[model samples]
Target: MSGVWVWVEQHDGQAASVSWEAVGLARTLADGLGEPVTALVFGMNAAALAQEAIQRGADNALVCEDETLAAFRLEPYASLLSGLAQERQPDVILAGATTRGSDIMGAAAVDLKAGLIAGAVGAELSDGRIVATVPVYSGKLMSKVTIPEGSPQMLTIRNRAFAALEPDAGRSGEVETVAPVLPEDEIMSKVVGFEAAEGEISLTDAAIIVSGGRGVGGPEGFEPLQELCDVLGAALGASRAAVDAGWISYEHQVGQTGKTVSPDLYIACGISGAVQHQAGMRTSKVIVAINKDPEAPIFKLAHYGVVDDLFKVVPALTQAFRERLGK
Candidate 1:
């Protein structure tokens, strides 16, 4: 592991957007440290993605194509990544702070005894060590974490925190085929199947989101917000209180205990902007809060505050957007 290593997260041969962002970060860090960027890709029939990784900025790629890795099972993925890290001894490892990326990286860190920085909003090489900027105390403050000079420095980058470089289709690099570290029979766990959420945008990848809270009143109260989301082509999200109240599923929860999001625009309806919820979406580029309570905490941090009833306001906004966008 003499080079800067980035684990390119992929699904069904398509790469995650954050994987490319991590590559962009890796390219910058590698340039500063005078190291080559090496991408590690694993999945069934992921050779094309390996090539795409090179086009995105990796100097070379190590690809592992196996049926065992077709679905992300922790046992095989972690075993393969950790074994490779031990053998190659990469100076640094980067991955997206996605479910699979975080899972495998955490396991690899334990196996290799490497220092891992999770949920890093930004990072740079300082004094030959990685200094990662992490949010703490529910986004109220930023904490700087420095990985000491030892073992491989690993980091899971928060989505949208770094810009991905435009791919150069003409660029060429080396691609090395690798094998899985564990045998199928030896692995304890297996991926039975996947039940993906349909017709909904991923919160981490969404550019815009329309979220509801306790203020939405009940499960049916989310209908107006859903309409708004449809008009905006945005993902529907919810505060923990709404989720706890059974108004929405946990998958739609956006808070410290749920999925972290960093969208370009976040419209919070009937949300009180609790610190817990803020931790998940405080990084959104533009925050708009629509609450009847003028003194709602969400108004304090929102770029635009609409003090009104969300039921009334949301429908109006949806209709306006539909008319304007010609939807």
Candidate 2:
């Protein structure tokens, strides 16, 4: 029978947070569809990991294990997963819009001959159909799309758009193994060396972000905000203005072309809040703007606004937070 299935991605046997996030989103969708949430785990040592789906609210977890599956491989994963979906006839399949997730989704979509939607932020299950919300035109626009005809409708959602769900101890289920899943010889992609990023937490995963822009004067001006961010246990972010002006690295930029963040709190220091910048962080739970010009567009969307020099105001705010949070 058809149900909501989440593709769990793991790295070296460790579960990816994006998979848990997908499980959370799938649980909501399943609740609306009045169906069960089943996570599909494909990798080695999956026995110890199946409990995650149940603890996180999945009704059942479908495990397909292999030693070769310990690493990500586009060819075998796409072949195996799409083949399974065809056999099981799931109502819908959801995955994170991570680089790797998007790769697998695209490959599987072609094989399944199914309609695909990327960067979905919202979903609704009603009238025996799944309607997905997707952003368009570099996030300048948005639209709702539905698959009129498909056995397993597919969608990939932007990370952090949905809040991660806490484990629900009351909800428990079983882990079933999908028979004859994949063999090492059948897998095409092989694991090479991994260059893990060091000493930097990406803005996409941060809960709090302290961002600066061209108005911050120069690259050196970001120091104070960095200090504040460090004290706040937050990540550093930059506007396109700062990045374009060569004041900050593109990796630090938050915009349509850069990373999109829906942090718990987003503090903009001297940023003018261009459309692109807003596109990235407009969904933040709480927004604070520290720009001298009250006329700046940033204040229009900010929950809190200060019309003063950021150099003076930001330090004061930082001190206040440090005194309060003792950081």
Candidate 3:
């Protein structure tokens, strides 16, 4: 009756990477709390995903399968998950702060009357209760929070905030199927279509990222950055300045108001390193900055820095990487 639960979000019959990452964190929490880690998977073909959950660190899995649950419709999915929470009475629940995860968790919180924390960067047990460290004021400060007594603690973590558990084929666990109890009238929304972005890697999932800023000069300035990204097999990112100037699409922007990324390596070209911009990518493993201004704040955060014109430095760096990579 008392356990840590993770919501496994899946897409195209495959589990999302963030869901695996959450399971890894849940494994740690469950161990600390001396409880089992349970994964809740919901979709049309969720049994396979449930197997993946066990391999990725879950002690057991609960799968809910139905045609209406295939594509994420808020009402039915929330109703099923919230109903399960009421019946199973899990102690803590964790989910990724993705579009689908956020929507479903928010609705479930309302249905179960649970205390919810959004965008938690870290979580651990403190004196027999779950405490989470959450970002506030655009990542300027972190606040530790605990759910009130008599409530199931729920948390939504940002993508890439934690490392994923490596899947092991040798691992095994139990899987239980839960029938969906949805009335036709309760399912109000339907997903008619889904279109994926063209020729772009997800920023949060990319190991390497090449980002441009205002000093890139114009839209054409991104050409060199793109070349470097291509050579490194990296995603392309932009600062809010470049995005606001119409030099790049908003989808490519990395900032407080934009997407957050935690790549293994991040190369910032001509970016001044505003607090808002840094908030999104500061978690990256290694930061490299190239700019003419030696006084730029980005240098403070960069592990490696070059004080030179980005126009010249970027192309030189690109050509050097191309040769080194045998591209």
Which of the numbered candidates is closest to the native, going by highest lDDT?
A: 1
Model 3, 326: alpha-carbon shift in Å?
A: 3.3
> RMSD, each candidate, Å?
1.4, 2.3, 1.5
Worst-scoring 10-residue span by lDDT in model 3: 181-190
TM-score of each prediction:
0.96, 0.91, 0.95
In terms of TM-score, how similar is model 2 to the real structure?
A: 0.91
lDDT of 2 by residue, 129-247 (tens): 77888877767788988898766888888877776688877877888887545677777667878987657667877889999997899989999999898888899999998999999
Better of 1 and 2 by TM-score: 1
Backbone Cα, N, C clashes tallied per candidate? 3, 0, 0
Per-residue CA lDDT of candidate 1, range 193-268, in tens?
Answer: 7787898998888999999999999999999999999899999999999999999999999988988888999999
The C-alpha stretches of model 3 lying farther than 4 A from their native spots are none
**CA displacement after TM-score superposition, residue 10 of candidate 1 (Å):** 1.6
* Cα lDDT over the full model 3: 0.90
Off by over 4 Å in 2: 179-191
Q: In model 2, which residue pairs have backbone atoms overlapping below 3 Å? A: none
**Model 2 lDDT on a 0 to 1 scale:** 0.84
Clashing pairs in 3: none
